[model samples]
Target: MNSDDPLSLTSKTSLGAYYESHHVIGKRLGQSFEEGQRGPLLKRWIGTGRRVLDLGGRDGQLTRHFVDGNHVTIGDIDAGAMRLAREALGVDTVEVNLNEALPFADASFDVIVMGEVLEHLPYPHLTLEQVRRVLAPGGQYLGSLPLAYHWKDRWDVFRGKKLWMARDPTHLQFMRYSDLRKLLSTYFEVVEIVPLKGGKKAVRWPDQFARVVAFHARKAAG
Candidate 1:
């Protein structure tokens, strides 16, 4: 949908519901969450003092982990998601559309997180450019994306159904590791590309699928 379309607002509610349900389930599962597997990257990239911007951070499930007496702003296009985040985590939030330029001033954030958000946007390059603009020189950006040929896609293919990644109207793009690396290279220097370890059951065939694609990138110095 185009910018200013009412449907965009309505869709946010639907997306928020999906996110809340999944986040609640993930929290209950504890160790099953991807956060634990992503710890190394977070530890390496995030320092003790920094201001963070979490773009499309639904319910602030992951953002809360990084906000330890540091400035952290959770941003999403969905107001319901923002409300859920504030109520559950008591974090500050802002409503923003990722397809458009972000409202923050240049170099306003020391770090930016866009976990699992790249696939949903039609214009990821624009989002990355905005990300580069908002982050201070040498600032870090951390996030994950579902890689192509993941188990979920294979399961859907076996079942004669389209994968959610392919069929979801809101997911405008899918990327392989190489493609994502190439995209990020234009805006930031790639630091790490780590394959996420799934739950015990999914770990059997490691090469066949990964839970997510986690990466760290740093905005280039001027």
Candidate 2:
């Protein structure tokens, strides 16, 4: 499959299946493991009483963490995913294609979570731009992305052999830390970059492979 063609219908279906299975496993493991990782970032938003937009919130697992007493809306391109999330987590949700502009009005949210979503977008920057437009000034944007070295560099080898990250076909982009940072800086003032643990190592040295990066950024007040 060509790397650029990530939005193929077949790919979307495959991703839907993968996400369904992944969430099942995550549920069995308990939500704490996932929610615990967000402690540092979540603490910053706690008690702020802000509205949140969770972009690409598959199955709403992550959205549940922040919706206890806050207004949260989950959005995703896949209706199946959104339905699953709504049914499983009992949260409000909208169907949206991230590559296209978001449907909300400007400054519509105080926080936007793009967790594990950008890599699937064909035009990640466009989504970020919409994110900036909808976020209130000083609103936080918290999320995570897969680093290039994550998961044993399977994609890299696939790329070397002329395969694309969108092998399942819904992933339009694959970004390393540097690339994502540079891209996000255009629309947001990055405040922090947190590395996640337990990823596979590509080399003996620690620097060789860093799998995931979580970031906290704020939309600039006009």
Candidate that would win on TM-score: 1
**Pairs that clash in candidate 2:** 166-169
Model 1 Cα displacement at 207 (Å)? 9.3
Candidate 2 structure quality by residue, lDDT tens digits, 56-118: 776666676677777878887556667877777777888776767788999999999887777
Candidate 1 wrongly placed segments (more than 4 Å): 1-33, 39-44, 150-159, 198-211
Clashes of 1: 0
Worst ten in a row by lDDT for model 2: 2-11
Task: Kindly provide the TM-score of model 1 when superposed on the true structure, using C-alpha atoms.
Answer: 0.76
The lDDT of model 1 is 0.73
Best prediction by lDDT = 1
lDDT of each residue in 1-222, candidate 1, tens digit only: 543233443444554454444444334222323776555456556765889898877766676677676688899865666787788777789878787889999999999988778988888889899999999998998888777666777788899988757754456677766778899999899997677754453345434565467889999887
Cα lDDT over the full model 2: 0.69
